[model samples]
Target: MHILLHDFAGHPFQAELSRVLARRGHRVTHAWFAGDTGPKGRMARTEGDADTLAFLPAGQDLRYSKTDFLRRRAGDIAYGQELGQAICAMKPDVVISGNTPTEAQEGIQRACRQTGTPFIYWCQDFYSVAASRLLARKLPGPGHLIGGYYRFLERRQMRRASRVLHITESFRAQTDAWGIPRERVSVIPNWGALDEIGVLDRNTAWAQANGLGPGTRFLYSGTLAMKHNPELLAGLARAVTAGDQVVLVSAGVGADGLAARAADGTLPGMRVLPLQPFEVFPQVLASGDILLAVIEREAGTFSVPSKILSYLCAGRPIVLAAPGDNLAAQILRETGAGQVVEPEDTEGFAAAAQAFRDDPAARQAAGAAGRAYAEAHFDLERVADKFETLFSEARNGL
Candidate 1:
């Protein structure tokens, strides 16, 4: 099968999916906005460069965030038409896109209609107004207006698409709120990108580079985005008892604010390391005694994060700071591999951290469980098989 994949966010999952499909003998072509913060260079078509399919004309990039929905623009329709032309030439067996804003999705759907392709919307991020309410709390009038407009466009896209690949079971419930039928949605949670997951001996390097000791290492990797309440981890760092140290290695531009928060002498046991290439993530993760996945308490948190999958695959115990009802927390409970506490409950997080530091046996047991669970459920090869089955079923009109 020939597949055309559009990922405005360029998430590693998209690239991992493409590689898995290619390995399975499918001709997979991937497209995305290179500037997207998620995947970075992982999905580049050529060495050191983004794929031409992901290229966007200057001043025409259609970015959609919580605040982007209210501003109605003609550029969206133009971008949609442009995408339609690109897919028309591919003559793909299927057209699929992930994390595309509704405005861009409109264009992709129109393109699929024009090219007679089966379109699938893979919802990694829920662009619901509830997300804005949860994160921003008080959005400006313009933001609210944009949110309303995008929601309407998303509803339209749901009606047109052949299927919706959701990152969480909760995502389907959210889409159903917009009237998408049950048959049109499928659940495929995020999986570890083995291509991105490689070894890095950060522990040995940390001693020479940062003069760190063999303290119980708690690691925080990835971006310092607003949704990621890393400050909470910093706050909990002050409560670390005995020989526990929190090592924060943040990447990308989003780390600036988090760095500032960490540097203010607010969190005693925490240290912020500079960003490194994405390739070293697995090694950095391996150096840690526990991995911290923190998110703010809010309505939209039921959404799953890609980091949880990566942490699980690293075979490290996870100290997740999210609502218990969230998919991340639920997965932890289901796997019996990690501990989940409510977001903003710094005392709970600190206690969990102290308990893990004191109980090595318990930590090892949980870590082993997480690693096994990841191998069983979140492995790229296994996930790709499920995706291929879904694609075949959708194309066969089953």
Candidate 2:
């Protein structure tokens, strides 16, 4: 079978999935937008048996610019059209679209319908909910109108999909209301690329080289967007005792915010660094005494932070601030691999971090438990097998 997977955000896991499917005797094409600035810089294409296609030209980074919102929206529409044309040209046996903008998804759905191709909606997050939240803050009166428009588009795409692969069980309720049958929806949570990440000692060379050994490092790695609560790190820094030696390290947007705060003498003991390369991810992850994950209360239900899965692979105790009902928080509670606090509870977040910092034995135990859970549920091969079966089923109209 010829399989095509598209993730607008250019997630490495999607690329890994293409490789996994290729290894399983299927021709796979993983497609993504070139504008996305991941850990690795933009590439027109990647060399592999499973062809990697990057649509759009390089140097189109517009994700963080509020002034370019309208321009970005127009770009999204153009990119969608381009992606639709590419899909039509490829004419793969099956297409799986994940983490796509509603506009792009609609384009793909239309293209699939026109070409008579079976495709699955690999929904990692609901864009309509996010759009509503973001636009409500930016443009109060017209936000609802625009959000409703996207929701309508999303419903159409969801209804037309041959299968809907939801990352969380909570997503099924909304799609079910669209009259999508339960049989057509499957909850296949996201997984980490365990082959690329391994458990390493905190005293590894990377840790020592980065000056991470002397202090209790609390690291937050990955994109820190509107969905994250930046104040959580600020409050944690302010609350830690003088002798605690608790340092906060951030790599993405959060790092930029924290670095600015540190410059202004507001956030003490915070170190900001650029995102590490994928090759040294394991070592970078291992340098931390504890990993931090935060989600805004409103966004928690619509999205699960994939960083939590990667943190699990690093064998570190995680401290997550999210709604109690969030899938990420629920997993932590069930596995006992980390601590979950309400998004607004700064004191609880700080106390959890301090507890892990003070007690090495407890931290080690939690880290071990997290690794065990990752081994069981987050192995890349296991996740790929599930996707392979789903793709085959969709292709065969099963």
Candidate 3:
């Protein structure tokens, strides 16, 4: 089968999905905005023919560039037309859209209609709710307007999709609210690279090279956006009085403020390091004694953080700061691999950190459990099989 994977707001997970599907003996091609810089692994040939202009930032926090913003809304129309052309040319058997923007949604839908192919919505995020809430929280006036428009597009897109693969049950529930048939939606959680499980010793080598001393390292990798709550992260920095050192190696956009604040504080044994290369990410994650999943209380407490999958695969104990009902928290509790604390509960997070630091056996047990859960449930090969089954069913109209 030939597959065209599209995501206007480019994400690494989309690329991962393409790889999984392709490895299962399907031809895959990726269509993304020109400047979206997520990883594109061996899944398929990447073609930057997708309809939206990229909004990439100049520096580390990687904010959307002004050029991208000025061109995005209008370019989306062009994007849709071009996407339609691509579909006509490729004539793929299945079309998958990964969290598309408004313009791409309409474009991809048109392409699917014209090509007479089964369409799948690989839901990485609830675009309608997530994007609207994100914009409303960050940019009120124009953001709210755009968000409302995006929500409208989201409903239309969901209606047109032949199948929807949600990241969690809660995410799938959102689609059910729209009166889409429940059978059309299935739960497929984000997966970790199963190939990464064998690299434990590499973590030591990476730490030595990076000057991260041999001690209990608690890591919080990824972005530090507004939804990430800088103040709480700062509090955790200040609260780490345990003998075990606290080192934060941040990568991706949005960590300058946290880094600046961490520097000014007189917290002993705390170091904020720069983001490492992707090659070393697995090792970096493995080297850590514990992983901290930080989401602001206001960023909607129920959303699952992608970092959890990586942390689980790395075999680390997690201290997740989010609502208890969130899918991530539920999974952590179910597997006995981590503990969840309220996003704003500094004392609770601090206490949890201290307990892990004090109890090596407990930390090891949690790490082992996390690794086992990741291998059994979050393996890429296993996830690929799930997708194959779904794709086969969608193709057969089952």
Candidate 4:
């Protein structure tokens, strides 16, 4: 079967799935929005990749401004049109899309319907919900109305999708509200890219380059968008045990805010750097004694922050600031992989950091637990089998 898998943010594990499907004798073309300045995994064909596997970088030259609503909307429309063209050209049996804007998703699904192809709505997060909150903040008066239109489009897309693949079971409450059938949706949680990321110690060359480590480095390595609070990051920097520093690898609005604070001496000497290349990501991750992730309370449900999963693969203890009910937080609590504090709990977040830094044995244990979780969850063979089954079901007109 020919498959088109489009993860707009160009995430790591999604691309890995494309490789696995191709190895299973199905042709898979993994596509992504190359212009997004987010942490990406191996999107290119490796020497070991099968000929059936390929990569397509959609909108490699498009201008994407995360903070500008109108500009982003326009970019989404353009990307959607380009992706629709790819759909017609590839003529794949089924297409799976995630990390896509509502407008783009609507367009892609319409293209699938027009071409008589099955479309899988990979529900990584609720884009319409996020857009609504962000838009409301940006445009006070007509924001809800604008968000309502996108929500309408999203509902239609959901109702028309061939199948909805969700990353978490909690999404059923929302989809069920849309009156989608129980069988039409499936929950397959996201996993870390264990195949590509190897375990590295903290004394690597990456730490040397950064002039940071061999000591405790708490790394927050993901999208620090509107849903994230830069103040919490600043609080983290101040809260960590002295001699330990916090690293923020991000871009866009949050990056700007953090950089400003760092410059003004308000951020307490935290390292605010732009997103690094994926080639050094493993070492970058390794430089951290405790990995970090943050999401605001408003974005607790709408944002999953897959960086938590990536941190798990790094064999590092995590210090996450999010809602207790958030899936990532729940996982950390259940697995003892790391510590989770409330998004607004600056003191607790700091305490968690200090505790981890002070106790090497406990940190090592948490890191071990995290790696164990990654190993158990990311069996590529089993994962590919599930995708293949879904594709076959879609082909059978299920």
Candidate 5:
């Protein structure tokens, strides 16, 4: 079967899935936008194993802008049309869409219907909810109106999908409210690249070269957008005591904010860096003493941070600032891999970081537990097999 996977944000895990599916004798094409500035970036379009194709439309930029709402909306509509055209051209047996803008998803769904191609929605996050929260915060009165428009598009696309592969059960209620049948929704949690990320010693040359060898480092190594609270990281930095050699290393959006704060002498012992290449991600993850994950309370259960899975693979104890009932917190509690603090509790977050820093045995135990959990539950091959079954079922109209 020929399969096409579309995601506006080019994810490395999707590429890994394509390789796994192709190795199983299925032709797979992973299509994404060229404008994603995430960790994968251009590498997502260029690197893939044999029998798997990475498709990025030439000269197409679909990155969203915070300041230019009208321009961003227009770009999404244009990109949606282009994306539909591309899917129609491929004419794959099944199309899977994940992490797509609502408008773009509408276009893909419409194209699939017109072509009689079965398609599944690999629902990673609730886009309409996210847009509503963000726009409501920024635009006040008109945000709900704009968000309602996206919600309409979201409902149409979800109703049109042959199957909805939800990443968490938390989404079931919303889909149920939309009148989607329970049988049509399946819960398939996201998995980590256990093969790529592994336990590495902190004494490696990469750690020493990057100034990560001398102190207790708290690292956050993924996109920190509006859904995350950067001020929590700033608060953690401020809470570091004089005797503690705690350092904060951030490599994404929070890094930019923390860098500016450092320049102003507000965030001492904070080192901000650009997102690392995928090849060097293991080294970057290993350099940290404790991994950090944060989510805004407003995002609630609508989004789950995928970085937590990578942190699990890295075999490091995590300090997550998220709601207690959020999926990240639930995973940490279930796996015994990390500590979870409320998003607003800066002191609690600092305390957890200090405990991990001071207690080597506890940190080692947490790391080992996380590694064991990843091996048992987050294996890439296992995840690929689940996706294969879903694809087959969708193609057969099951």
Candidate 6:
């Protein structure tokens, strides 16, 4: 079958799945938004890749501003149109799309309908719900109404889809509320690139070149969005003792602000760097003494930080600042991967980071547990089997 996989963020594991499917004697085209500035995967086609595999750009190189709703919405629509044209032209047997704006998803659904292709809604997050909250805050009076329109569009598109794959079971509530048939939705938790993200030595060339390691380093490598609580990150930096460095390898408005502050001496003892190339991602993760992640209290279970999964693969103990009920926090609790502190408790978060920093034995134990969990759960072969089954079902009019 000709399969088109559109992952808006161009994440690592999703691209790994595409490679697996391609090697299985299927024609697979992995597509993503090249303009996106966050962590990306092995986007370039390597020489060892099967001839059946192809990587294509589906979104334009327009200025991507998350805070500017009007401009972002226009970019979304333009991307949708471009992706739709590709879908129509390729006329693939199956299309799986996720991490997309609702407006762009609508266009993908439309194109699938036009081409009579089976469209799978890869529901990574409740984009409508997040957007609704964002719009409500941005346009207090009528923001809700505008947000409702997006919710309606999202529900309609999911309802129209042949199958819907959710990244977390928390999405079950929304799908049930959407009145989508119970059989149409399935939960396939996201995984890390087990083969890609290996555990490298802390003193990797990348780490040494960046002057990161040989000392206690609390590292964060991901999208540091507004909802991620930048102040807590700053608090973590401030609370760290002198000679300890907080390194942020990230992007997003919040991260940019933190970087600016760090540069201006307002936020000290922090080294902020842009997102690094995928080739050096393993070294980037390994350079840290302790991995760090954060989520606001208001976020609850609405989002799962994919960084946590990747961190597990990196065999690093994580210090996550999130609510107890948040899935990532729960994973840490279950796996004994690292420490978890309430998102709002700056003191607790800082203390946890310091504890991990001062105790190498504790860090080693926690890191071992996380790597064991990753090895047990992040089975690419098993994951591929399920997706292959879904592809067959979707192609046969599921």
lDDT values of the candidates? 0.70, 0.77, 0.70, 0.86, 0.79, 0.89
Model 6: residues >4 Å from true position, as ranges? none
Segments in model 5 whose C-alpha atoms lie over 4 Å from true places: 41-48, 57-59, 62-64, 242-254
Off by over 4 Å in 3: 7-17, 31-63, 66-88, 102-104, 138-145, 199-203, 242-245, 251-253, 263-270, 396-398
Q: What is the TM-score of each candidate against the true structure?
A: 0.83, 0.90, 0.81, 0.96, 0.93, 0.97
> Whose lDDT is greatest here?
6
Question: In model 2, which residue pairs have backbone atoms overlapping below 3 Å?
Answer: none
C-alpha lDDT (0 to 100) for residue 204 of candidate 3: 75
What is residue 166's positional error in candidate 1, in angstroms?
A: 2.1
lDDT per residue for candidate 1 within 1-398, as digits (tens), equals 88887776555656767766776677877777543344343554445332323322212364533224344245445556677777877678898787665666787888788877888888876655444554346566765665676667777787778888887777777778888888888988787764565434447454446666678888887666656665567666777765667888765434565567568865667777874545555667877888887876754364566678778777778888887778889989998888988878888887787788789898888888887876777567778888898888668755
Order of all candidates by TM-score, from best down to worst?
A: 6, 4, 5, 2, 1, 3
Question: Residue 193 CA error for candidate 2 (Å)?
Answer: 1.4
The all-Cα superposition gives candidate 4 an RMSD in Å to the true structure of 1.5
lDDT of 2 by residue, 323-347 (tens): 8878888888998889999989998
Model 2 regions more than 4 Å off: 38-67, 241-254
**Candidate 5 lDDT, tens digit per residue, 1-398?**
89888767766667677777877788777777666556662234344455455555421655655347787777777777887887788789999999888877788888899899998988888899888878888789899899888888887788879999998888898899998888888888988788888899876666677666466777878776777788877777787665333344444455677788887888775667777678888888888888888898777568788888888999999999988878889999888899999988888888898889889998999998888988998777778888988988899888
Write the number of the candidate with greater lDDT, choosing between 1 and 5.
5
RMSD after CA superposition, every candidate: 4.2, 3.0, 5.4, 1.5, 2.3, 1.3
The CA lDDT at 164 in model 2 is 91
Clashes of 4: 0
Q: What is the lDDT of residue 263 in candidate 3?
A: 72
Positional deviation of 30 in candidate 2, in angstroms? 1.3
